[model samples]
Target: MTDTVLASWRDGTAKTAILDFVTRATRQGPDFVPAGDRIATFDNDGTLWVEQPLPPQFDFVFRHWAEEVKADPSLAGRQPYKALIEKDPSFLHGVATQDPQVIESLLKAFARSWAGSTPAEFDAQVREWLATVKQPKLGVLYQDLVYQPMLELFDLLKANGFRVFVCSGGGRDFMRVFAEETWGINKENIIGSAAEYTYTDGGMVRGEQLLGTLDLGPGKPEHIFARTGRLPVFAGGNADVDIEMLSAARFALLINHDDAEREFAYTAAAEASLAKAGELGWTVVSMKDDWSTLYRNREQ
Candidate 1:
């Protein structure tokens, strides 16, 4: 592990709490961690990076779809995806939640559109795209905008025998791309919402040949169970979609982005779920109040 000092945005209280958790957890020395029980899960989108306005992966796919529409012109009149390209905020918030079929259709289209490439090839594409892409609001590379405090926390926990995992609602393949390239974490340890794919002689295949339901919300816990068998000891997230997964953990933390100056201040369906966590004894960390820094500018 690296000798990195973890800082907190709050008045040192959150930092104290975290260090206490780490100390007590490792009090039994180097071999103290519970066998196969040193699991810590994190939500990727809002918790780890900027997700407001749109998720980075969605923005990437939408950019591709938008370019296609520009070529066809007629594609501007199509449903859902068209609305998405036009930057219809309501279309994403409402349709994605209220209309199940719409979400399924969009995801299927994304899978089909990006399929036919080997996992390695697709990962390379994502890495190249992230290197060149900049966030509209932050004026920084998407990868540069990762939360610094959280990154430090990841290292701190790892030093204390915890195996950190990103259990996100974003595309598993997309997250894996960034995780492997930027953090040096193994792809197999990172789990997220996914569309099914089939193995072919040449490479993995998608579309009709692929069969499975997309993972989301409650399905997160199910996927974790199927993959790891052991429940997580610690979990952190910033959305209602993560409630079930958080609830399944022994120690859960919620990152509330309340800093309007540093980051957008907005609320979502995740609030009620967070309230439930409060009642259930989960720790809630306010971004504005708990984090001293917003991002560790990769350019720096």
Candidate 2:
């Protein structure tokens, strides 16, 4: 049954555990979860797609910032711009590790970049970026890099009456642009750090202030509960920032990017999460061993 359900997943303990959990959750037993409360949330970066080099959202924002620097040379003196100008690996490393101070700095600038733009305007900008920019190493559009195995898992969960949400620390508006087309999830189901909005001049416009929180660490479950009214029964993530969310779930699956041959492998950001997985007895999915394929074909 697991073989037919999770086609891109190899036979392994991770697969078996997932199948067992789902079966128990669906069956009428002590561990069974009610359908309405069957919620699964996953961290976007690393867990659902490639996040190396930089997260795709940062790549999008950085492109715009580069052009911003070109337009006004004075802005180049500031951080993010300064970091980009000098090609600072430490700044990039901070982002990869989801260092809070680093992310907060970026978000402040991000909010300023499109302060008063309407949703349609923001969406158009994202669409343009998606159409033009390709992942650095893969040479394919970023949207095409979503994992096929994760998508199959989504299908299996949905078939068994689970509501899945993609929760990320990246911009919610950015992900919503391609959520339906790329992840096959409704825009509302894509939860992330978001800017507040104001209704003015007969339209909704973005505000410089972030909505509530930056959606990292504790913010993940906070945002999930705020939006869904409950914590996830199942959750998946692959970095230190995800530990809180993973720990909150009944079944947690952590992805280990140990497949340098098919996909880039490094434990730079995932060390703590891996340790937590071991300590908590959370199921660990090895990219090299558990997944038969790394990505969906570009044509897909």
Candidate 3:
């Protein structure tokens, strides 16, 4: 009976939309969703954390690749290694957003760098990266860069029996590392792009080949259905890659990074997603207006 579910959210259309959805989704409500079907999917990177310059996973890949390039100069000429060698901000920005060529190269680099390690080994590598790396402008650890308001939303959805999942364009194993610690979601609920693995010798070993779909853009829905076996009823995202996933949901939430001062702002990367949200009557959450705080550590 208290208006405290999404307390971090300002009283606006964005906040109001979430309240109404949860209320209608309760057991007594006419439009209540079954407990089993109360599925909520979230995108990581720009949606859950800071991804302005580039996704944090890309930073990890670059750092590892840089070390590799140092050991072997020959790897520098490759498609993805070249991008890492240049370390161009523009290229990084392009990869972060929607430059298909740059995105392809980045994905390739990621697939190549992460290959040959077992799941346990891969997780240890990500944990090491998280401990060492910090966001450029935020200057905080990557795990600390998560959005405060979205975290509240996750809690609200969980309290209301919504099964939350992090369906990201980022690596599945990479996200599973922090999904439980950072987002309080089960690692089994995380779904993302994957590297192929084979049962060779004894255990499942990761391969250099990228398997399954890219899990970006149209690939989001494909991967989600493949993993969860159902279309999401509630979906949240920050960029165009999430458009397909959001479109498949009954209640779509789009996080628009319009807060230039508190957080970085960019609409170009998600223009088409924004347009689709408008057409689909999705809730467009304005970071500048809807959220009182930028991140978990800093509250307004």
Q: What RMSD, rounded to one decimal, does every model reach? A: 3.3, 1.4, 1.8
Which is the winner by TM-score between candidate 1 and candidate 3?
A: 3
- Give me the displacement of residue 3 in model 2, in angstroms: 4.2
lDDT for each residue of candidate 3 in 1-300, tens digit (9 for 90 to 100): 366777778899989888888888885767888888899999998899988777888888878888998999998898677865787677767877856566666766677777787888888988998998888987778888899889999999998899999987778888998888789999899998778899988999988877776878888888888887888999999888898899999899999999888778888779999999888899999999988776887644
lDDT of 1 by residue, 1-300 (tens): 122458534555566666766676677775355846888888887888888767788778777787777788887787655787676877788533323354556666777667665777777778887989898987878998788888888878887788888886567888887786555578898887565677788667544322345455776787787778877877888777788888988778788778888887866757776688669977777788787787885422
For model 2, name the residue pairs that clash: none
**Candidate structures ordered by lDDT, highest first:** 2, 3, 1
Taken over the whole model, the C-alpha lDDT of each candidate is 0.73, 0.91, 0.84
Candidate 1 achieves a global lDDT of 0.73
- The stretch of ten residues in a row with the least summed lDDT in candidate 3 is 98-107
Clashing pairs in 3: none
- In TM-score terms, candidate 2 sits at 0.97
For TM-score, the strongest prediction is: 2
Cα TM-score per model = 0.87, 0.97, 0.94
Strongest candidate by lDDT: 2
Q: Candidate 2: list runs displaced more than 4 Å.
A: 298-300
| lDDT per residue (tens digit) for residues 141-212 in model 2 | 887788988999999899999999999998888888988887789999999999999999999999999899
